[model samples]
Target: MIKRYSKSMKKRDILVIAPQPFFIERGTPIAIDLLVRNLDNFGYSIDILAMPIGVSPNYDRIKIHRSLNYLNAKELKPGFTLKKIILEVGMVIKFITLMSKCNYRVVHAVEESIFWALLFRPVYKYLLVYDMDSSLVEQMVNRFRWLKSIENRLESIESYVCLKSDAVIAVCNSLADKAAKAGSKNIHLLTDVANLREQANIECKEDLNEISQNNKIALYVGNLEAYQGVTLLYEAARLLQQDKVEICIIIIGGSESDVQYYQNKVNGDGLKNLKFLGSRPVGMLEHYLMQADILLSPRIEGSNTPMKVFNYMASARPIIATDLNTHSQILNNERALLVPPSSVAFVNGIKKIIENEDYAQRLGSAAKEYVFREHGIDQFRRRLQIAYDTLK
Candidate 1:
């Protein structure tokens, strides 16, 4: 464990709490990594307490306490089931025990872990900071109808945390508005940031000259969840079947089940143009992004403004996204090709891009410029610093 004593009497100690271990490729892990890396620049020292759910080997410098020996179960059958209740209680106990041994100026809990911090707020002698990345309430309500009771309880827990915490950081304006409605006085909108320097360092070694000459590749780099609209991409491919436009949709990063599900869908529907490359390492993601003619963000109505969108912007690739509030906030109609969340619209958008290469290039250039000016790591670090400094 790397230990450091407080040099100045006023230097605040910050503890970042999350369910997933740091350095993972997921959005939350990426956010944690950025926060940790910018700690010194923000004039604070951070100790992390992350669940061992998806522990990564890259986090050697940060002190981590593993908790909750729980299995990854997909189905949600009931609320307050005996086994789940026991697990939740046990995890909370372990978290509190570990927290008791450490002294910190602020307790920064991310996502659902804010519920645990709220439960132990009275005993914890520090300012609580709730860093809500997504609307858990909205997600729970959408995912499981039977968990309405549990969802209400979780919402109450979140509301309690927001009410009690010294400060709150939401990743988007919509979430920030929700936090404000929840009575959080010190809510700040901290948009997702791209580690552009690292992404730019990825060498584009793939010889895309031949591929680029024949076909226009539209890439979708994210999980294969239903809300992500992967099926719509397949339908869009079907729509443009005989247009004489050679277009390929490359999907990267999804689980085994996701791969099988999408594969079956595409094959069953006889869509040969959509290719599933499965999951790739973070280093390879940039290469794929670089090779693409356009990036697609076809998310359905949900609380997701994926961190990958920022990476897409950083790649400086022409983007075609659904005309949703989340996408509109980042890639306004001027910077990206805005289409409705439908197969026909997506197909038309791609056709538009293929027809006007100059417009596509202009949009790509403008999108990259916007991202660097607003959503770069330096901007993220500054916003975080301001939020931390505002904390009592």
Candidate 2:
């Protein structure tokens, strides 16, 4: 018989320090949701101390605690900003207060919040688990070139925290490798699974009509952050129009501001084939996926796989992603088309997929089968169980 996490400690309680929103229709929060639910299944109670900016999870065995939001921030803007830093400070304070009241058996910190866990480990001495979502050092330096001046210092801090943590749960293989290189005592790989649940809101008014008889609908989902490389899609679409291949690019989710920003760019540039439908209920993602002829992941930064790729794979829609490690780790020439991170290369990829319908369908079918068999919720739960057992 296998050991159970609930029996490892007297309290069977965990303090989860999630630096992001508590409940959001995004990448990290969704992963956190699965963890919380699975821990509940294993008879563990969780107290989640999160940023005061999202909907409460309101689970049975979980209590949601929000940091003091002096700014009354309703929603945080994407990327690292002054606001995010202020929120981090607030989370640190709240974490300290929570720890002082009750002694949790485990302190599970996600992403950058691992810093606070490391700082307070000596005082509390709880089993510390670092949930490595992405390389914060890489994100900071890539988004802000000036951070390059102190990149080594940042890496040192990250490595030091990894070394101190009891266990590091990496979201991808690349992150697990980084953890090992940083001298982490224990490392576990737990990747995000596809969210394929469909919603009842089917009456979405999308202008995805193939204007010409030869038009194909290529859908892209997720925030329109600069790192997402949304502009690359535009550049590729412009080139495709020049070549007279009408690939109508339908962007499904993003902030209102990001939607306007990209919409303005497309409008001014006279790129008639691109459409932005703003943010949608993630449940409606399956509906859009079913309607899409091709899926696109054009992220230009970060090695961690985009959460949307799993959804794309489950949708049975052929994916065309950048040839970077971000997609290479999950995709290849066999399951999907991998092109260099260039507009010209994406233009060629789109043409090839559209020209040969049989090849595109084969790629989609293989991707769907692979993900369902190897990356389903059961696999996530098993991996998470094995990771938590390390604490014993």
Kindly provide the TM-score of model 2 when superposed on the true structure, using C-alpha atoms. 0.94
Q: Whole-model Cα lDDT per candidate? A: 0.74, 0.85
Q: State which candidate has the highest lDDT.
A: 2
Question: What TM-score does prediction 1 earn?
Answer: 0.87
Q: On residues 321-357, what C-alpha lDDT tens digit does candidate 1 reach at each position?
A: 9999778877787789989999999999998998898
The true-versus-predicted C-alpha distance at residue 36 of model 1, in Å, is: 1.7
Off by over 4 Å in 2: 1-12, 198-207, 210-214
Whole-model lDDT for model 2 versus the true structure? 0.85
lDDT of 2 by residue, 1-392 (tens): 12323433234478888888768888888888888889878777777899989998668667888999978898886667889999989999998888878768888999988887888889987888999999999999988999999999999998888898989999898999989999886899888887586333456554456432347888899998889998899898888778778678888888888899888888999987888889887767787788889999999999799989998999999999999999998888888999999999888898899999999999999999998887888898898988887786
Which whole-number lDDT from 0 to 100 does residue 169 have in model 2?
95
